[model samples]
Structure formats: C-alpha cells, structure tokens
Target chain A: EAGVTQFPSHSVIEKGQTVTLRCDPISGHDNLYWYRRVMGKEIKFLLHFVKESKQDESGMPNNRFLAERTGGTYSTLKVQPAELEDSGVYFCASSPGGDSPLHFGNGTRLTVT
Target chain B: SQQGEEDPQALSIQEGENATMNCSYKTSINNLQWYRQNSGRGLVHLILIRSNEREKHSGRLRVTLDTSKKSSSLLITASRAADTASYFCATRDPGAGSYQLTFGKGTKLSVIP
Candidate 1:
C-alpha cells in the first residue's frame, strides 16, 4: 500500500507571506496527525484529526496557524503571516487507530526568508 | 514543551556493532514508541512498547520500557551503514483521549561502514 504523501516537498516564502502544506493519509486510515520540527529541535505535535472532526488541537502554537481536514482523507496546515520561526519541516502521519503504528509522509520543508 | 529527552544527543558506531539509545520522559504514559528518519526523509515507525510490556523485539531492533523510571532504550543489533539515521522516542499520555504523541529531540546515529 502507498504510504502517506505530502505535497510540495519543499516550500520557500517570505517571512510575512502565507504558506500552506498539504498531507494525504493512507487509505482506510481513520486517524491523521500533524507535526513540525524546527531546526535542531524536537518534532512537536500540531494537531490530530479523527475523520473530519478534530480530535486534539491543543498543540497548535498560535492563532496564525490553522489546520483543517475537510473530507478526512487529507489535511492542510496554513501559516498566515509566516514568521521565521515558522520555517520548519512539517510532517503528516496516519494510523488505523488503537495501538496501530503511524505511517508518515516525507514532509514539507518550509523555509521562510 | 517536549516530554522526552534522548541521552547522548548523538552516537557513532562501526558496522556490525550494536547501538543503544536511551530516552527519558516525564509524566505517566500509556505507551512509548521509537522512530527513524534518514537524511531528508520522513519518519518511519520502528517499534512501540506499551506500559505493560517490558520488552519487544522486531528483527534487529529491540526496545525496552521501564515505567517506574519513565525511561526507555532502543537497541539496534549488528548495525549497518544503512542504519545511520536519527532515532526519536515518542510517548502518549495515559489520560489523553486522543492519540497525540509527544516526541523528544532525536539521537543522530552515524554508522561507519
């Protein structure tokens, strides 16, 4: 089976510009998650989606960042007025729920100049 | 904030040697997992050990969890150059209804072939 896939493997934007990253989870997976890793830092959870509804968003950093999973098959993360700190690799993962292991995408590398 | 912190931060080993990485986390957890990421690639799930599980083995990978110490260790036997990558530990809170994972700063392993 195909693994999770992310779009625009690399993105570069101005510091004040807006950027959006997309993720497509594996088929039949009911759980989707977003995570980001800043340079030389730990990968941190951003949010989680169970089908079309968000299960947890407490990890979202600020109001400027928004994530949505419209049809529950894919997810998008948007960073408005992106800051330098928003430059990082954004990863998407999906699972079958329960104790299943997550399958991750190659991630979108966002570079804010 | 990151919940788990990997010890050594980095490691180097010769081919056919074994590599061990340790992770220490705070707070109670339901399970602990390990992941690997090659350069410019996405994370791949290595293994998952539940709170009730003391040890798990998958091929050359062995994982041990100690809930009382809030720590875990990942051992890669007969390491090869292909095993060179960053290894990370993630944990899910026992009380959290969502399967959100908190990750640690990974240990970058360099296998000298």
Candidate 2:
C-alpha cells in the first residue's frame, strides 16, 4: 500500500510571506492529521480531519494558520504572514480510524527567514 | 514544558545488540505509540500499545507500557545499521473533549555494524 506523500519537501521564504504544505494520505484512510516539529523540540499535533469535516482543531497554533481537506482525500496547511518561529518541519499523517496506527509523510521543511 | 519526555536523548549500539529507549508522560493516556524517522524525514509507525495493554511486539520491536508510572519503553532487538534513526514516543490523552497527542523529545539511535 502507498504511504503518505508530501510535496515540496523543502521550502524557504522570508518572514511575513505565506506558505502552503500539502499531504496526500493513503487510500481509504478516514483520519488525517497535521503535526510539526521545531528544532530540538518534540513533534506536536496540529489538527485532525475526519473525512471532509474537521473533528478537532485545538492544536492549531494561531489565527494565521489555515487548513483544509477538500473531499477528504488530501490536506493542505497554509500559514499566512509566517513568522520566524514558523520555521520547522511540517508533517501530515493518516490512519484507518481513531484506534489505527498513523502513517506519516516525509514532511515539508519550511524555512521562514 | 513537553508533555512527553524520553530519557537517554541518544543511544549507540553494535549490530546484534538490543536498543532500548524509555518515555514518560505527564498525563493519563489512552494509548502510546512508537515511530521511527530517518534523516529527519518522514516517520514510520513502529508499534502501538494501548493503556489496557502492557506489552506488544512486532518483528524485533517490543513495547512495554506502565500506566501507573506513566511511562513506556521501546526495545529493538538484533539491531542493524539500517535501524539508525530518531525514535519517538507519542501519547494520546483521552481528556475531556481533547483527543490530540503529545510527543516526547525523540531518542536518537545509532546502530553500528
């Protein structure tokens, strides 16, 4: 089975610019999630999508960040007016269900100067 | 503060040896999972052990959970050089209306052939 795939493995942009990260999960997976890891920090949960609807978004960092999962097959995370702290590796993951194990993508390394 | 913490931030072992890493969480968790990332890339699901289960194994990977202690461990037996990667432990706290996960600072493992 195909694992999760991410695009634009590496990204670099100046502060205040916007960046979008994409993730395509495995087929038939109902649970899609977003996570990020800062340098020397633990990975963190960002949000979760059950199908086309968001089940939980408490993990979102701030208002400038937006996420969407059209048709629930893939997901995109957009950070507007990105700050220096936004620089990190953003990962997307999907699972079969709430109890299923998650499969993650290689992640998109975003560099906000 | 990090919700989860892993001891022995780094580990080194020879081929045929066993690599063991420990993780501790502050909150009560519904489940704990282990994942491995190579070269800071994507993560691969290693194993999952629910709160009710004390132990689980997949191939050479063994996971043990202790709810009373709020800790977990991952043991990789017969280590190979290919096993070099950063291993992380994530915990899902089944809090009121909160289903997000908390991850620990990963343990970097190096298996020398």
Considering every candidate listed, which one attains the maximal lDDT?
Answer: 1
- Runs off by more than 4 Å, candidate 2: B96-99
TM-score winner? 1
Clashing pairs in 2: none
What would the per-residue lDDT of candidate 2 be over residues A1-113, giving only the tens digit for each residue? 99899988999999999898999999999889999999988898889999988989988999999999999899999999899999999999998886687888999999999
Candidate 2 residue-wise lDDT, B11-97, digit = tens: 999999999999988888889989889995788878889999999989999999999998899999999999999999988888825
Judge candidate 2 at residue A44 and give its lDDT. 87
Model 2 preserves the real interface contacts to a fraction of 0.80
Q: Write the per-residue lDDT of candidate 1 for residues A5-55, one digit (tens) a residue.
A: 999999999989998899999999999999999999889898999999999
DockQ per candidate, 2 decimals = 0.85, 0.74
Fnat, one value per model:
0.85, 0.80
C-alpha RMSD between model 2 and the true structure? 1.4
Candidate 1's C-alpha runs over 4 A off are none
State which docking tier applies to candidate 1. high
